[model samples]
Target: MAKRPKVNPNEMSFLDHLEELRWHLIRATLAVVVAGIFAFIAKEFIFDIVLLGPKQPDFITYQILCDVAKSVGLDESFCYTEIPFSIQNRTMSGQFSIHMWTAITAGFIIAFPYILYEFWRFIAPALHENERKASRGFIIIASLLFFIGVLFGYYVISPLSINFLGSYQVSEEVVNEIDLSSYMGLIRASALASGIVFELPIIIFLLTKIGLVTPQILKQYRKFALVGILIVSAIITPPDIASQIVVAIPVLILYEISIFISRMVLKKERKEKIEVKSITKN
Candidate 1:
């Protein structure tokens, strides 16, 4: 394979910047497509083991929750032998379409670190040498946080929501025949949403860098952020209090982490300003 030519950002025009960005995007998309093909080939594992895991009674999440509930002398709600719903494909192309999309989603998740690396490469040229060095681990940290969030969603939120929604019914006569698309949609949405939500500290850091966010602002709106986090938890997880609380706890912790990050960023910026001032006065 040939290497990509490096372009000096200082000499690049607006159109040159656009061209550079376009190439970065193309490389990122190609990475996703390649990973997607692999995921597509692993259809059985992807579908039966991963995407459908939350709905299965023998899922690890269910087993763990069952054990926890039993140890606590709580109701055996998580100890069920099976969920009360069946998934079906109502349309002719439903399975095929879902397979393709699920592969793409898996590809994105698997290739997230590469995507972030591409993103960093595109932006790094514009930053000072010190800034680039400071953010050297950006891709790794962001990717790790995202995967952690994805695992939380899959093990904690998805199974709980699947159990609650799949078994829920207004009457004994009302059996749920969930559409295949809907079932997969819930899993995909939960995982991806949580992944993005876990980037809270990164987002706060960038906003602080741009002077749009501060530690005080995050602290002042802590209560409001709590309400928002709860609402987001309710939306992503089952509406039950237990499920919502389980989902909200990590997000609340992330919010606190974001505040600390914002404070650190501001302190760094102030120290830089002071150094610049001292050099100028001398």
Candidate 2:
């Protein structure tokens, strides 16, 4: 691909920046729409084979969990014959709305790289050439982290939550029946939230670059961050020690990774500054 000529932000009018941003947004939207079209067309594959995969008893996660539980001489808590729930549509238009929105969500996920490219394009011109070079793999790294988080949420969090909540009985008086919209919402939220959470290191990198945060500050607040992460874990997963631990472990790892990223960014900034000083002295 031919390199894009960098625009000098100092010479560009405010209106010009807005105009450039508009087209980037337009292209991002187009990419999502095109991906959504495919999601809509392959509704069965997306819905039955992918989205509803966790809801089935035969899911890999359930099988693995069952094996571990049985080996430990505990109840095979996850060995469900079937998820004790039925997902239903309550409204006349609920199914259609669900279809459209689900497709859009899938579209956004599939076309995320393109969207990130547009986002980078919008901001790249404003950054120093060296900064842009340093961030050349931002989109790829971000996408990879996001997809990993999605898989984690799908394979770990979703099944954990679904199995616990699905089988939980309140005196066996209430049968579990979930609305289609509700189940879909849970799946989407878990996936997207985890995806965003996994971008902690990237966020830390940006914040460190802009002088808003540092490795020292992160270390200083380590205890508080631990508490906050626990609370977040409770919110995302079932209110249980095991579930919370499962969700929090990766997030804690990400936080530690963010500290490392911050240290690296700060070190690089200092080196660059020293180089500038040496150049001026010469």
Candidate 3:
């Protein structure tokens, strides 16, 4: 392969920018693929422990839920010795397909920080020097929020959902023999959805910086946002009130943090503009 010439981002044409973006994407994809290979190799851990954990009664989440329920004098549905449902591979190649896709999802989650870094590098050139410096911790903060969200989903949301859905049956005659793909899909959706939702603060920061959002607007629409969050929580979690509340709390907290972040961003921008004006007058 020929050596790609070094070109300044400021002087780059549309095609040059496209080429740059392509390389960034390629590197990000390679990172995911590499991480996926490791996850694939660790199939025993991934499948038996991580993926199948919620089905087991002795899982940490279930134990905690049992304790909490007992203390709070609430329903002890979570204290069951076993989940009644069984996971099965109905179709030929079902297990292999689930394994492959699960590995890829694992890879994406593990490689998320590097993916963020690649994304930041692509956009960094367009930002002013001070802007880049101010947001230097972007990748770290975003990654931290994402990982925290994943843990919350895995530990809280996934367990609650799996317990309720896996145990619920229309009749005693109908056994809950969930397909392998379907079970994996629920786990993936819960974790990824929560992780993405936790990026609310970062999204708000960017929107505020670009003058598209204000703290006032977020405050004014707080009621609507709460409704939306509850709706989202309901969709992802079981039909029970406790489950929905558990899911909504963190998201609502994140929304409030987003509002604070937006306020700070605007304050910083105002201070910068005043300094610029003073400098111009001087």
Candidate 4:
């Protein structure tokens, strides 16, 4: 295969930059489409084994929760034999539409690393040699954090939310027959949302580098952020305290990590500026 041409930073005009960006975007989209096609081919496994795995009673999250409750000497209500909800398609074309969309979502998730690579490629020309070296592991670290978030969402948030919402009822007369699209939406939302949330530190790092955010500012608004986190948790999980707490813990941890990242970034930037000043004087 022919190697792709590299962008020449100094020689590129505005039009050339746009052309380069267009190709990168095209390549990224093609990657997603190819992955989506594979996901479409694995419809049964995708829908049952991966997407709907959390709804099963034997899901690892439920097992862990059961153990924790037992250790605490609480009621074994976490040990469910079955999830009370039944998922079905109400619209005639719902299943097909969902399959297509879900495949695309899966494709996007699977190809996220490559997408980031393309983004880095676009931005690399604007960075100094030192900056590029400093960010050498950007793709790997960002991808790892994203996958970790995905796992946390799939194994923790999705299962907890499903179990709690699937079992909740106002009266015995109401049957919990969830629509297939609705069920998939919840799983997708939880997983994608968590994946993005896990990028908090990276986001803060960039913002700090660009002088947009600071550790002190983050500290000052910690209480407001707490409220925002709680509200986000409530929106994503069931209104029950257990479910909310389960969702909030990791997010709070990520927020603290973001603060640390901001501090580190600021320190590095300041040190670099001081060293540059010393060299200029010498």
**Model 4: colliding residue pairs:** none
Per-candidate clashes, comma-separated:
0, 0, 0, 0
Residue-by-residue lDDT tens digits, candidate 4, 57-159: 9888889889999999999887889999899899999999999999999999999999999999999889999989989999999999999998888888888
RMSD, candidate 1, Å: 1.4
> What TM-score against the true fold does each predicted structure earn?
0.96, 0.95, 0.98, 0.95
Q: What's the best-to-worst order under TM-score?
A: 3, 1, 4, 2
Best by lDDT: 3
- Compute the lDDT of residue 58 as modeled in candidate 3: 95
**TM-score of structure candidate 2:** 0.95
> In candidate 3, what are the lDDT values of residues 1-62, reduced to their tens digit?
56798888989999999999999999999999999999999999998999999889999988
Off by over 4 Å in 1: 1-5
* Higher-scoring candidate on lDDT, 3 or 4: 3
Alpha-carbon lDDT of model 3: 0.94
